[model samples]
Each structure stands twice: as C-alpha cells, then as structure tokens.
Target chain A: MTLERAVAPAQRAVDILGGDVSESALKGYLEGLPGVDAVGLEQRAAGLGTRSIKTSSKAWALDRIIELIDLTTLEGADTPGKVRSLVAKALVPDASDLTTPRVAAVCVYGDMVPHAVEALGAAHGDPDQGLVSVAAVATAFPSGRASRAVKLADTRDAVAAGADEIDMVIDRGAFLSGRWGQVFDEIVAVKDACRKADGGYAHLKVILETGELNTYDNVRRASVLAILAGGDFIKTSTGKVSPAATLPVTLLMLETVRDWHRWTGEKIGVKPAGGIRTSKDAIKYLVTVAETLGEEWLVPHLFRYGASSLLNDVLLQRQKLTTGRYSGPSYVTID
Target chain B: MTRLTVPKTYKLYLGGKFPRSESGRTYEVATPAGEFLANASLASRKDARDAVVAARGATGGWAGATAYNRGQVLYRVAEVLEGRHAQFVDEIVAQEGVSRAAATAQVDEAIDRWVWYAGWCDKYAQVAGNANPVAGPYFNISAPEPTGVVAVIAPQDSSLLGLVSAVAPALVTGNTVVVVASERFPLSAISLGEVLATSDVPGGVVNVLTGSPAEIAPWLASHQDVDALDLVGAGELDWPALEQAAAESVTRVSWPEQGPDAATPSIERIRAFTETKTVWHTKSLL
Candidate 1:
C-alpha cells in the first residue's frame, strides 16, 4: 500500500482533533499540550523509585515484567542462528523453571523477522498458550535519516515478512526543527504501511528518540504528536542514544498517555527502551506506570521494556527468590 | 589565647567511602578508664547488607588483578599505615588504656603484619596449589581461587593488630572483605580505613563497619551473597547459632583460635577463603 491509500484513518484523527492537519495547525496542537515540570518530574520519579516491593509482590512483578518485555537484539551482526536462540529464550526464559511466562515479543531488525517468526512457531506447539509476537524496528531504525519512500518500504517489508508489530523511529531532526507536520505525516504513513491484505494492521510503536529531543517540553510535545498521528505505542528511544529511557522521561511519557486517554478516551501504549537492565529497575518502571496511570497499564498490551540483558538479571533474581539461593550469570544464557 | 581542638567523627567505611549509617544511629566510645573518645556510627543490618553488595561488586576486578598487582596494593596499604603511624598510636593509647610504648609497638606490629601479607600475596598460591599425577593420559592440577565476598568480625581485644590479622589474609588472596570492627575499640579501625582509602586498594575491596558484631554478624553470616564468614571477633557471643545460620547458604565459617596463636600470620588463614579447583584434560596425539 502507498501513502495515499493510508490517508483516511490519519485524516479522521486530524479531523476529530479539531485541526486542519496543516503544519501550523499541528504545531499549535503540539505546542498547546501541557509542558513538563523538569524538577518536579524528576523528584516524583526518584521518590517512586524508592517504593519497595518485596517477596510475593516482587515475584508477581517479575512475572509481569517478563511478559511485558520486547526481548530485542538489534545489532548489525544479528544472524539466523542468533535470532533463533533469542526466540528460544523468549519462548522459555527459564527452561528449568516451567512456570516462567513467555515474553510479549521477539524484537529484531526488519531482515531477521522471518527467522524469529519461524523459530517461535516451531517452539510454540500450542499457538494460544505460547503466542509470542515478532516486532521489527523499521524507518531506518536507530537513525530515522532515510527518505519517506524508503522508510515506508522498510515498514512494509517487515509487516510482509511476518512482523506482528512495527517499531518506527521518527525523524528527530524534523521534530526538533519545528517541522511537526512532516514528523506526523511520516508516522501516519508508516502506520498505513503496516496494513495487511486482510484489513489487519500491525501494531505501530513510534520512537521519539527522547535523548536527542533535549528537553522535557519536547518529549511531552512529541508524545502528543505521536498519539495524534496514530501511534499504537509511543516509545522513548531507539536504544542507540546515551540518555535513553530515563525515569523522568518515562514518567513524562506515561503522564502524556494518561492525559491523552482522559482527553480522547483512546488508550495508547508506552515502551521505555534501553538502560533498564535489572529486575529492580523493571519493577520501578512498573510502579511508575501503575501509580501514574492505573493498574490497567500494567498489562503487556499497555507497557513494555525494550531490553536484552534485562532478562538474564530478572531470571537470576527470580531463581534466587524461588530456590532461596543466590544465582550467578553462568546458569543463564548470555545472548 | 586557647585554640579549640576539632575532634573526629568515627564513621563506617563502606566501599572505601566514609558514610554515616543509613539508620542514622550512633553510639559513644570511651577509653578503658571511662574517658570519652568519640561517637562512632552504630552500623545497622542494612549497612552490613550494603557493604556486602559493595564487596561483591569489587570481587571480580580484585580477583582478576595480577598477583603482583595485589601484592603491590597490599604493600601500598602498609605504606599508608606507616604514614599514619602517629595517629594510630595516639588512638590506640587513648582507647586501650595501654602505655604509649605498648601502643607504639601495637601500631608497628600492625604495619608489619600488612607487609607480611603483602609478601604472601604472590607466594600463597604456589604454597597452596599442587600438581597431581594421575594414572591416565591426562594433566591434572589443583589451584586456589578467591571465594567471592567474605564477612569478618574483628577481635574485641588487640583492636589494631587483630583487625589487621583478620582482614589482610582475605584481602591479599583477592577476596573482598566486610569487617565488623571491634565493638569496644573501633576508633583505630576507622583510622585504618583512612589509611586504606589513601592506599591503592580499590573501593569495596575492604569495608570497615563500626558496630556490635552481635547486631551485624547474623545478617552477614546469613547474607545470600556472602561466600564466607570469619568469626574471629565473636568473643562471648554464641558461635553455634551463627554457624547454624551460616549453614543456610553453606557459607565457609572460620572461628578464631582460642590461644595466642590466633595473632599469628599463616597460609591457613588465606586458604580458609579460597576454593581449590582441579581440572583434567585428555592428552592425545593428533
């Protein structure tokens, strides 16, 4: 499908939002979104980070954390074997402990989606019981520097190659340069390209690359713009930036989604990717979501962590809680 | 005109930094004659747990360092001790009610003990390891490796010398230590922390906590992350209960010797916190 065929749904969102869908109108809508209080946001995030969840509650959080993880491997050297191993890990995070929950998805680059899909299919004999989605990072991935047509084709290729979800990065340059319409149109076009022949569309997570956006104001603005442009999920970063997925940034994004739901009655998902490596950190993010939004956002459909090493730490901690003994990294796979 | 003397606050040394106890509790330490010395930070169980975490974090890098480098680091500790010799003597004299000469001798002996361990760092592995000859076409060897994090209870008496004796062996073998300083006399131990921080020793390699061993020993003995416990300072406390608690994790426990020989430096102290791994590989002609 081309960009023209995908215009109707986006045009409806623009129409409902009471805007002309022009650059100035889109800019005004984003700018009029509430600004973030930097110090207050950080203090609240840090305060919530100290809320201790122990024992049974911790165990429950670990299981939910595993289920909400987008187990990602986005290196240039990813191969079929690597993707297969990652898929196996995603399917049975702890082979020794059968009660472990399967992850939400096996995320990979666009070219590796087929391998992940095939591996997941072979492992999950009962599709309903162990259904793991495959997510591909498209739209030039970590860099989002490609032309619109190429980015659209990237999204289309992944969806055609068995990707149940497409993670597209927004043009940070355009978003920062006040070109709100271009950024919004790119997301709408990518969301359109996720369309399948059977009228089903892949879930779209728009990456705002909050690290490069420079301010909490821009992060809040981008969150509203992505939601208005029809993002199924608003992701914090591409895992390639330095200050990716910080607590305050995720808190701001969570508040944005909460307010957006309140205003439009449409619930969008939030995924904070990168630098979240420990079970404690994952639980903190979960606490933020539950406290900022409600218990409804604690499910896999509403929240996710785009992490790779986080699984091993979570597994190690979970095993410790189960066996009543400390575990080392040797017991877990190092992928 | 009189000049006011500024006294020091004895704080816990955790991960090579002086931090007040998270519990924000402090207790007063007095000389044997009941003269006031200084207020010491009364470390809590949480402080002990944090020290273990710091010690565990430093174990990998400390153990991976070359034996020569560890030797150099230990020697650096001795050098720093010598530089602070006068302060240690003064504190020892004030805390222990000993003669100034006896205090000086204790300070010197503590410094020499560090030198002794410094020399043994590169040599203990050879003394403790062996090459076993098997009746098969294989090469078999057993070598000692540092057993992760260790928790120590510094002796109640012989504060400076005893503290050095318990801490040096574990650290020279590349194992990180969380030591509960002598309950009655903790000032010298905190001063030693100043010496250690100035030395080349890495942060978390040797953490000193000033508090009751009875209060903190149970936590360290049962801590899942601690690999071993040296109950040299248990004194009149119940040893069997600590041993039983330590059994939860199968932590290696070493009790202090009852006689004068407890002050002696030996490779046995070093071996108490090391694991000997023997490997066999088939020798074949290709």
Candidate 2:
C-alpha cells in the first residue's frame, strides 16, 4: 500500500482515479474504466486485418516490419552461441540481400545480454539511431515470481551487461488478486532499476502476459497501469503462454496506448510478442498500428514486434518479391 | 418438402486441411461432355509453396518411420478409401463422363494401387538396396532412403488412377508428396484427400492441389526444399522448362512418357524418389 503511494509519477493518473494514490483508489479507477466492447474490439481488429497491402506497399511493410522487430530467442536451451547468432541475424536479417533493414533489437535472457551486446559490437545502440539495441528479459521473466530485491537486481544486472532495453514480465498473481498497488510499485521499481552507471535508464517494456490475465478489461487495466508506472512500452506477452498476442488483445492494448496518448500527449508503445510468425501476421499488426496510433508510431523506437521466426518469413517474402518466385526455408537461416 | 442436393466444395488439401486457393480463384471443371462440374481451387504458385512446406515438414516423421509402419499407415488410407468407394466412383463418373462400370473400375484400380504400394513399402528397400562391394575391413551396405519431398504433377487425362499411381509409389518409399490433381477432373483426387485425412496418413504427408499444372509446377520444380519432381503428368504443359527449373535446384527429374492405357504403377517410380545411402559398418573393433 505504501509502495503504491510512493510512486510519484503515477500521480498523473492518481488525479483521475481519485484524490489519493491508495491501492483501493487505483483499483476503483481501473475497474471503473469502461468495460470492453468485446464484439466491437474484435470486429475492429479483424476489419483492420483485412486491409489489402500489396506491391510497393507490401514491400514497404515488410521492410518496416523488419525494422520494428525485436528479434528474440528466449528458451532454457538458449546459449551464448544462440544469442550471438540472433544478434547476427538482427544485424543482417537477410545475408542474400544487404538492402534488408536490421531489426530494432535482439531480445535474450538477462544472462545472455553480454553475448548479444558483444555480437552486435559497434552496431549496438538506439534503434532510432540505425543501430540494433539489445533487449534483455528480466525480473524473473516469463513468470515474475521472484522477490522485489532479486527482480531489481536482475534488471540492474542486465543494464550493466549492456542491455539497452529491459523486457519485464509483471506479477500476474498480484495484478489478478487485486493487489494493484504491488503490481504498480514493482513496475515502478523495475523502471528505476533500468538506470545505468551513466544515470540514463534503459527503456522498460512491461509484459502483461494477457493470456493469463483472463479478460480484455484486465488487459486494458494492466496496460494503463504499466503505462502510468513509467513503462516506455506495454508488451502483450512473454511468448511463453498459450494464446499470446492474438489480434483482439493487441487491439485492446493499442487502444489503451492510443487513449493514453490522447490524454497525456505522450505515446506509449505496444509490442505483441507471441504467435506473430508470418510476414502476413506482422503486416496486420502494422496496419492496426498505423490505423490506431497514426503514421509516427510506425518507427522502430515507438513500435516493435517481439519475435524469433518472424524474421525468416519476412526474408522469404522479401525474396519472393525480389526474385518473382517463391522462396523456401532453405534460402533462409534456421532459427 | 424437397430435399436439397448439396454439392461438395472442392478445395485444395494442404497439410491435411482443405483450404480454398490463396489466390481466391476457382476454375470451373467441366465433364468430358462439356457439362459443368464443381469449381476446383485454381491453386496458384503460393499454394504450391505452402504444399511444399507441408510436405517438407512431414518428411522427417514419415521417412523415419519403419518400413512396416509406413505400409500399415498407407494400407489404412486404402481402408478409408474402401469405405468412401461410392463417393469416388460417383465423382469419377461425373467428372470423366465415363460409364458407371468404367468409373467403378477406375476407383477400384485406384484403391488396389494404394494397397499394392502399401505392400511394397516393406519390400521396396529390399529390392532397391544392395550390399556394397567395397575394398575395406568393413561390411559396406547400400540402403534406399526417401529422397525427401516429391512434387508429382498428376496426369491430366486419367485423374484418379494416374494421381494414385504417381503419388502412391513416391509415398510407399516414405517420400512425402505434393501432387497437383488434374485441373479438368479433380473430384476423385479430392475425395482421395478425404481418405488420407481420415486414415493414418499424417497431415502434410500428402498435399493434394487442384489447379493448372503449368502455373503450379514450375514453383515446385525450382523449390530448393522439393527433392524430386515427377512430371509424368506434365505431357500437356511445357515440361522441358520444368526440367530446366528442377535442374537449377539439382532436384532429380522424372518425366517418363506415360502410355495411353493410363498410369501403370512402377517400381521405377518408387526408385525415382529414393536416394541410395551407403553405410560402412566396421566389421569388428580393431
């Protein structure tokens, strides 16, 4: 309860929620936000998915998607070798064609950040500056079940390891059980932990793990809380759970971000990590973003796709466009 | 009240699921007498690409199965086909404008062809493989392994029999297939797809595409993942160009001139899609 009051920045949201920054106050604020129009939200997402992007526009979307991708490899089996290769792919997504733009970042487990950083070499930095950033999944990632001290340490260690961005999964148990204060404070602390030796903080992406959150309303609330808690981006999943990053959920998150932008005059990014495997699927996300957040959020720093296999599919599509013939997996590197 | 005579929508079978063409284009398949049959998916190059992906994905499991297991799985397909015998017979009669007796004969032959290929699954390796004669202190043996995904363009004239003949042999050797059904007569081929889906044949092991061979064939020929191309059905299309495309990928090409008596099941068809793998086993620990 004290942690909820301790967060000074979320006071921006506190004013709208109630007179105070109490746990009950924020809970009421979230619960009071209009319940999701389930059918309408879904219909809008599906309608956006049907937009026909082709020819030059398709070529453009494919290249833009490559730039917006957070090329990720998160597994128990992930080795330094795997991180290096992932970084290499992020640097040069298609070896066959040098014209292919690099991905925004290479996402890895916090421990593998150094390898990604080393592999990226001089090319590592802000994606907006034409360099691929290294994003580390921290704070007991894929499941935020660790203590507060360990979670903060994980984030700081990743920043120390040269991660330019931290992808943190929120404690769903706290968020689901209505301990809104604890969830909000943890995100604030994780955001604080992103500070580097130079005092500049790494970008923080808070994963809601919407598949476990159980409802569109919860996803919207979590997205709003993450944004108010100083998350630079509100991500949809850790890519560990089933039903991750479906169109409707992403649409809901995008709407929250859109609404936040409308109220605060600041844009919060949304990254839909899992199940977005094909170039076609990624393009649908692009269409949704363009329609919701306008053309500017389409940039690498403002928007991103957290994916591993999606790059290869984009490469295959690129090859198809270039050669006027369908390319196969043999043409692209195996993830 | 009159009962509705519902027609089955013929879609392309890709990775064991029936999907309309990615191009969203369907061509009207007419009977030999010019009567209109159902619209068949005019599978574009994209659908062929998808089919190859499915076929390639199925290769590891299908090829690694014991020869006896493959035979049993294929025989299960025949069992399913036997149950749906009347459907294939009716479609064949309608599409080919053939006599009910002739259509029934064709359907029966198609089922028998599957059984024959199924039986050969356990025996083809024995007939095709050999004990290598190499000068070494080792037992050198040559075994036949499925070449990988085989792209077969079914004969346009004899839809069901030709498709069964071309595809079954490739499958018996554990090679997954992406067979293009006859553009003009695709009914029986799709019914066969239903049989495979209901049987033990794994999804992606046999992707049946119904479209223009000329449009879909070149993509499969040049696809690096496709290990072999059987163009026996490519007699009507510009087949030599397909062979040229297949040559670029180093994919083995099989374009034997099929006779007018319809496709005769051949051991060579099976041989055409199997790679000879030689292994040197140490005679004893030195």
Q: Which residue pairs collide in model 2, if any? A: none
Question: What TM-score would chain B receive for each of the candidates shown?
Answer: 0.97, 0.96
Candidate 1: RMSD to truth: 3.9
Lowest lDDT block of 10, candidate 1 chain A: A1-10
- List, residue by residue over B98-157, the lDDT tens digit for candidate 2: 899998998899899899989999998899888887787788888899899899989888
lDDT of each prediction vs. the true structure? 0.87, 0.87
Candidate 2 lDDT, tens digit per residue, A1-335?
01221223454555566557678877877888899999999999999999888699999999999999999999999999988888888888888899999989999999999888888889988788789898999999888999999999999999999888889999999999989999998888898888777666788889999999998989999998898777888899999999899989998998898898788677677899999999999999999999988889898767899998999999998998998766778889988
Query: Which run of 10 residues does model 2 chain A get worst, by summed lDDT?
Result: A1-10
Q: Write one digit per residue (lDDT tens) for candidate 1, span B1-286.
A: 9999999988999998999999999999999988788999999987987898799899999999999999999999999899988989999989999999999998898899999999999998898888889998888989899998999988888779999999999987789999999899999998989888988899999999998888888878767778899988785678778888888778899986554456478878899999998999788956
lDDT of 1 at B117: 93
True contacts kept of each: 0.17, 0.56
Best by TM-score: 2
